[model samples]
Target: MNDMTPRSFDGREYPYTPQDFAAVSAMVHAHSGICLPQTKTMLVYSRLAKLVRERGLRDFASYIDLIRRDPAERQRAIEAMTTNHTKFFREDHHFRQFERDVRPGLIERLDAGGKVRMWCAAASTGEEPYSLAMSLLGPDPVEGRVIAGADVAILGTDLSGAVLDVARRGHYPAALSQDVPLDLRQTWTRVSGGTMAVAPMLRDLVRYRRLNLLNAWPMRGRFDVIFCRNVMIYFDEPTRERLVQRLVDQLAPGGHLYIGHSERIGGEAARRLRAIGQTVYRKDAA
Candidate 1:
């Protein structure tokens, strides 16, 4: 069979045609702003095959029809299509830059009885936001408490409700904690058996919400630091440009924006943001 042909050797499963792939791809883009290329045909098939079987549907066509009519199933399909590959301190230098530059001003604001905010736009399973929390708070103890009191909030938002549940729990396999810095890991995380849990201090500073980037955002205030890394790669040029503009609009003056290393600022966002470090941009202070 060709690339477009379904891999049903025994004819026991549904035949996934090129048309089905195209339909699923378009539906994903329409609902989530994610661009699924032909290269992802097998990925789409593998991810949705279980759903089709669970629904007792023997064909991809019926599964597609059901999703088009059922909002809950549509959400599930989108969530399944989403790629949530993240780990603590995945980009170590970003966190280092954040601590060396971004945290000082935020700490100053907090000291002066001002509120500071951070947003992890693609906070898959909560590692990115939790990393931000650890970077902001550091290893120092305050008044015998490991968590230093501060007027700060880190908002972690993603389109996957299922991942949001994991983010809220702040638990992971113990092996995943390896990427975290030694001091930060010891201070901000707890390890028991094969499981690692983000310390209550880190959890206290972060909150998770299910938010579709293509949909309307209800947030009111600007963020001092926004981490929308590794997400724009899934979007087309127009979608990416619009999303960056929106991110800039929600960014506070003098705030920092960190994106995927492979992604670049374009169009209006290029003029609005200044590149300082690798994949990091800063908005001018008012």
Candidate 2:
């Protein structure tokens, strides 16, 4: 096997060297569809260093190799890398758009006997998808709809077995709850021990799963709206273009694709998808 020994960093052991980082990045991308940029060396070192020590692995290379071979070890590595930073309704305007523009239009379509499906592609820790569920399933809301939240992490893929254990419990600090609207707060969420959990009604409306966007999507039907936000920024231009095309292919006629505010789909992807707003794309009806 390769030298899987851990290196010392700032008096702590870390996996050093481009080779070590590359190996781990390949493994993560293959399993999760998240592309770790080359500049993210510090991020890799910082995130995985503690795990190395905690697991008593000698070096970064060995640890990665072990993970590659052992399914359980691979799961641990996925857990370490997939811990995303997020909050309820972190991007308020997007949710507002969902309510003010998307929801109304969708309701009109539904009244005409149309059904809707929405996918939250990188539903980190379940905040964005849960927020969407509340918007769609709240009192006096759209009657027929399907919402699917998928992430590459074990928590999401394993049906919230561990990561979602915390998510399903629906507890967050009071500060996190403050950003949620008061009406929404009263109707959509429950508070206990300074942590807020999404109401069961909303939670039940959204289904969470494990899916890697880089790989083939298992769902057969097209989607009317896809929130693949804030995830493509980590991928290379080629990767981004390919991922965008896949998303567009999964979109229904006149469907809208929402990307991260900072990300733009270029190359052939730009031709296939027309820009709708600052960070939104619309597929042609033809």
**TM-scores for candidates 1 onward, in order:** 0.94, 0.81
- Candidate No. with top lDDT: 1
Query: The CA-based lDDT of model 2 is what?
Result: 0.70
Candidate 1: tens digits of C-alpha lDDT, residues 123-230: 999989998888888876562152257577899999999998999999999998888899888888889999999888778788888999989999999999999999
- TM-score for candidate 1: 0.94
lDDT of each: 0.89, 0.70
Q: Which runs in model 2 stand beyond 4 Å of their true positions?
A: 1-10, 37-39, 138-162
Model 1 misplacement above 4 A = 1-12, 143-148
